[model samples]
Every structure is written in C-alpha cells, then in structure tokens.
Target: METVKLYVIVFDSTHSAIAAETMLKEENIANEVIPTPREITASCGLSIRFNIDSLDKVKNILKQGSVSVNGVYKLERRLNEKQVEKLM
Candidate 1:
C-alpha cells in the first residue's frame, strides 16, 4: 500500500473552520472541511485538510483572516497505520 501525507489546520471553533474553508476556496486552493481527527486533541470538531504544497497559502490566509487556530499538524497514513505530529 502507498502512504498518504497531508496537513490539517485545527481551528478553535466551528465558525473559524468554516471561514477558513471559504477563504481557501476563494484562493482556488483544494481543501476539505473534515471532522477534527480524534488523534488531534483539539477544542473544536472541525479542521481543514489540505496538501503540503498549499501550507504556505493556507497559513497566509489564516493569518490575514480573523480565524482562531489551534495548531497545524502533519498526518501520515500507510495501510492500516497512521502517524500524527504537531508542526505549529
């Protein structure tokens, strides 16, 4: 099986998550608003998942917007196993 790597931006609230999703969409960035993965102990239930290449753009949009962020995380999945790490 192949490994899948992605990054997730955990927001502080649902509103922030939704707002971030909109901002990313406006920039033509590919993203998905997913339930905050159980592996990440965050305050909110929503997170935006995007590819590594879009990290900088996502960060810039979040910084420019009023969204409250918890942190950024790196997620790696291979077969039935997965790894998670806090990057920010």
Candidate 2:
C-alpha cells in the first residue's frame, strides 16, 4: 500500500463520528475510524481518518449529508514525530 498524508475529521460528538464512518463506507471512500489524536484536542474522542486523495469526496459527502464536524486536521509525521495541524 502506498502511504499518503492523512486528514482527520473531528466531531463534536461520537454519534457524528460514527455516522461519518458509515457515510464514507457507503460512498466507497477509503477511511477508518480512529481515536482522535492526543496531539489535537477535540470534543469527541473519536474521529474519521482518510487519505488525502479522498479529501474532496469526504468534504462533499459531509456537506451534502449535513454531518456536523468540529474541525478537519492534517495528520503528519516527520522524524518519527507526529505533527497535527488544523485545516481550514
């Protein structure tokens, strides 16, 4: 498998996070449900991680489905250190 920079959708509630996973799955967008990284403090402990290639599709699905999100973040790693940055 090829490695890609990941983007995580953070939610205000676990319900939203789980719902998002279902939506992504239904749309056949590659994604995974993961615990929100400790480096980023979000309201919900759960989050959805997806490849950068799926960013636009995920964004559209969330918008069309009216999925509530706390924030979107870019999850990166360099020199064995995890770095997370909130995205607009």
Candidate 3:
C-alpha cells in the first residue's frame, strides 16, 4: 500500500496544542504546529500535523495525557512531476 503523508489534528485549545507538541517531541515524534486548516473546525485555530505512521501513537498520547483533540484527518498533496522527480 502507498504510504500516507499528511495529517491534521485539532486541539481543544492553543495551549493544549503546544503541550501536545512538547509531549510528542519528548517522545521523539516529528510534527509541526500550524493554524487550523479550513477543512477542520476548531476553536483554538492551532493544530499538529505529523507523519501518518505516527497517528496511532500520537492519538494514544493525546488520550492518555487528556489532551483533547477534536478531530484527525489524513491529507495528501499532489506532487507535480518536477517535485516527484526531485525526490527520486
């Protein structure tokens, strides 16, 4: 199966988003904090997107730590030939 590349995770608050980032980093998970993409509805307007492979572990961490993530989505961006070629 093809590997999924993107994710959008919404938090209950900006502080929770930041805390989640710190926790993920401490556990050696790679991710980024970004404004909530239009596709997702959230009050905090901040979220974390990380590699798809880390989805389960990240969700577990959030649940265990009481970090309320409103939603999660798998996202993919189309790569033009030039971009695809560069990666090859």
Candidate 4:
C-alpha cells in the first residue's frame, strides 16, 4: 500500500472556510470542504482539503483575499494509520 499525503487548511470560522472555498473554486483551484480532523482543534468544524502540491498557490490566494487561517496541516494516511503534522 502507498501512503497518501494531503493538506488541510483550518480556518478560524465557518464563514471564512466557506468564503475561501468559493474563492478557490472561482479561481479553478481544486479543493473540498471537510470536517476538521480530530487531531486538529480549530474554531470551526469545517476545513479545506487540497492537494499538497497546491500548497503555495492556496496560501497565496488566501493571503491575497485576507482569509484568516488557523493553520495548515499535512496529513499522511497509510493503511489504517494516520499522522498529522502542522505545516504553517
């Protein structure tokens, strides 16, 4: 089995998460709104998950739009095990 890596952007609030999602979608950035992982404690229950390769672009977009993010995390999942590392 191969390990899967992805990035999750945790927001300070649900509105910010949704707004960021819309902005990314409008810009044709691939992303999905998901529940905040148990490993992460955020103000909102929602988070944005996207490809790790898109990290730079995503950060730029959010910063340009003044979208506040709690933190960025890298998640690794393999088989039935998972690990989360803070990236920002």
Across 1-88, the per-residue lDDT of candidate 3 in tens digits comes to 4433558677788888998999999999999998876655544899787886887888788778867667776654455211111110
C-alpha displacement of 6 in model 3, angstroms? Answer: 2.3
Candidate 3 regions with alpha-carbon error over 4 angstroms: 1-5, 77-88
Ranking by lDDT: 4, 1, 2, 3
TM-score for every candidate vs. truth? 0.88, 0.85, 0.75, 0.88
Candidate 3: lDDT over CA atoms? 0.72
lDDT against the true structure, each candidate: 0.88, 0.84, 0.72, 0.89
Reference-based TM-score, model 4: 0.88
- Summed backbone clashes in each candidate are 0, 0, 0, 0
- The list of candidate 4 runs beyond 4 A from truth reads none
What is the overall TM-score of model 3 with all chains considered together?
0.75
Instruction: Give a tens-digit lDDT track for model 1, residues 1-88.
Output: 8898879999888988888888899999999998888888865888888989988887888888888899989999899898999877
Q: What is the C-alpha RMSD of each candidate to the true structure, in Å?
A: 1.4, 2.8, 7.6, 1.4
Model 2 score (lDDT) = 0.84
Q: Candidate 3 — which pairs collide? A: none
Worst 10 residues of 3 by lDDT: 79-88
Q: Which window of ten consecutive residues has the lowest lDDT sum in model 1?
A: 34-43
